[model samples]
Target: MAGNSDPLTPRAKIAVTAGKAVAAASRAAGRGSGSVIGGRVALKLDPDLLARLAQNLDVILVSATNGKTTTTRLIAEALGAAGPVVSNALGANMPAGITSALAGGSDAKYAVIEVDEKYLAGVARDTAPKCIALLNLSRDQLDRAAETRMLAENWREGLAGSKAVVIANADDPLVVWAASSSPNVIWVAAGQMWKDDAWSCPSCGGVMQRPGDDWFCGECGFRRPTPSWALSGDHVLDPHGSAWPIHLQLPGRANKANAASSAAVVAVFGVPPQVALERMYQVQAVAGRYDVVQFMQRDLRLLLAKNPAGWLETFSLIDPPPTPVILSVNARGADGTDTSWLWDVDYTRLTGHPIFVVGDRKLDLAVRLEVANQHFQVCENVDQAVQLAPPGRIEVIANYTAFQDLRRRVGN
Candidate 1:
């Protein structure tokens, strides 16, 4: 905000200032994250606070069950070439978090927001973003607290009435269905690593056919739209079949798929592919999503997952599992309270690798792993599990609260 000279109305400026003060006070008190309360204060003072702050900026709204944070960060980096990008990359995705972020970066010219699946429509209504990116629709039961099908419907309905152009993944059935109603949708065949959640067509309850990477409903004729942009090996493929090599700071085909979606997104603003791809390769981590935390002389790669779809992506990152892993789980509100999604994941892939289960829900995972005929050792704490890990680099795969707690423990 060194030279951000955009002026806000007097009342609106007052509201944003007050909100920031509240946020600082909340942080000083260590009451909680303070993201929610700060925005709550501002909105209570002026219900249209976010609208005022967003009046002059061109905003991009990113929503998805799994990759919202990472995708948002990538887009923010890509757009930073243009100007200061306001976003809640490290805060909450609800109304309050969005409010606080917008109020803080009030003078920014471009806003790249990460919105929770449930509050996407509400936030969009407040911000009136110029471009909307729907990554995929699914979440742990506690977030939106709605089933994936219903969430997709909500997104479709909300997007239909919005004026923003939509960039959607054509691979995920739910995403394709949800963004279908939007007037201007740019479909990208971003590969979906987890297909179990999208087994049936949301449109006609038809069994979809995955003859290859393409899927279609034989019964209702619903199918993945041909993507104008897609991934080809380690490069992004144009509709003309020209492949542009893209190397990212993040690993896995999933991140490449994310890059593909980000590519299409920035293109909506006439941002060149080189600018977007170059900016993306510099982003190594999004908050704690793919961070390496050091504790007790051991460096652990932190991978966070909240649901089965997330677990699928996480497991892919540890291909040919090297050493025993520190698997953590906690049934807290942030982690969705319900641990049933654990059973849905194909943990049998982890049959050969020894897993040191930790966290509040360790016993529950222990039982599930045993049922799958896998072997594991239960540790009392994350540190103890780390000590007992096989002599090599270890991965810390945890849910919401557990992941945060471990990161905090290591001074992250």
Candidate 2:
């Protein structure tokens, strides 16, 4: 409606009016597209209509490869502590999905949506949020996204004309470069207290030095100011040194980064650092993203490892020892049609042989594991594999679809 005008506008309007009349005439017809979770028919409506739907609402857009959902949920929770908040909790990251989530909440004071990088350019144009949280970009869904640089370029273009404040991860080289070009930017850095990886400079091809958690191009002197809000100081380690006590409900180093990013965004909204951190410590995990479940009388950690980068981050979090494990892979189109990226993962570092492999594409995973000279128990289904798993400790690593099936089977 805001763009090119069609000569059939009158006809289209008449048809829409008639359709609404007929739907009203039918008792089975309810409140329309905004009702269901994935129902996003509003996206097809005129741009003016969609624009009106989001007009004057405070919008927060969160985008990243790995931790977007967790960080988005955390920000939503922290903002909710101040006032009413709305978000797409079902992992809908596209334009239509965002429209559906916003359409459902008319009384919301703030709206936070986890937008996928691929969809950011298009969605940002329509929604035009007040704040955008640019989480670290990592290689993910290479089949669809091609490369992290491509996604970063799209984000830079999408945010070029935005009036919102941009919150970025300062430690990420790509983000640091992008934020340097933006006007209103807030850097969120994980202080020296935590060990994490930083990217090198592409211009000079030099190893970037991190003065604290803020990184700078060692050769180019390209570095932004340090973050005002940082996650630093004392850490409480788990008994086995596998996990550190974050004082937050969520676990892992990635979650800590998420917590730090969320705190920074909320701090921009006038929430004190201490208050935001206190509220974050009470936040819960978004379902399926490192969600802990009780299965077979043991703590079952279900992590969604959809790409090589995510898998690497997960591996860093768990840091498997010489203990046996269970890893599952699916090559279904929905879960990701191509499994060729399996070669990119350093599966050799995994402690011992994968005890069980289960999924529709269990054989494919088995072949990879076998090629690595690792023993595996291939099963037709997850339940059968779970039954055969050793009694001590079991870790289930699954992709999208397999993760869904595993949750249903485990009664989670």
Best-matching candidate per lDDT: 1
Error of 2 at 246 (Å): 4.7
lDDT per residue for candidate 1 within 230-251, as digits (tens), equals: 8777988766677778889787
Model 1: how far is 409 from its true place, Å? 1.5
**Model 1 weakest 10-residue run by lDDT:** 1-10
- Runs of candidate 2 exceeding 4 Å displacement: 1-39, 191-225, 233-246, 295-299, 319-324, 371-373
Query: What TM-scores do the predictions have?
Result: 0.95, 0.80
Best by TM-score: 1
Model 2 residue 388 distance off true place after TM-score fit, in angstroms: 1.8
> Which lDDT values do the candidates have, in the order given?
0.83, 0.66
Q: What is the Å distance of residue 165 in model 1 from its true position?
A: 1.2
How many residue pairs clash per model?
Answer: 0, 0
Q: Give the clashing residue pairs of candidate 1, or none.
A: none
TM-score of 2: 0.80
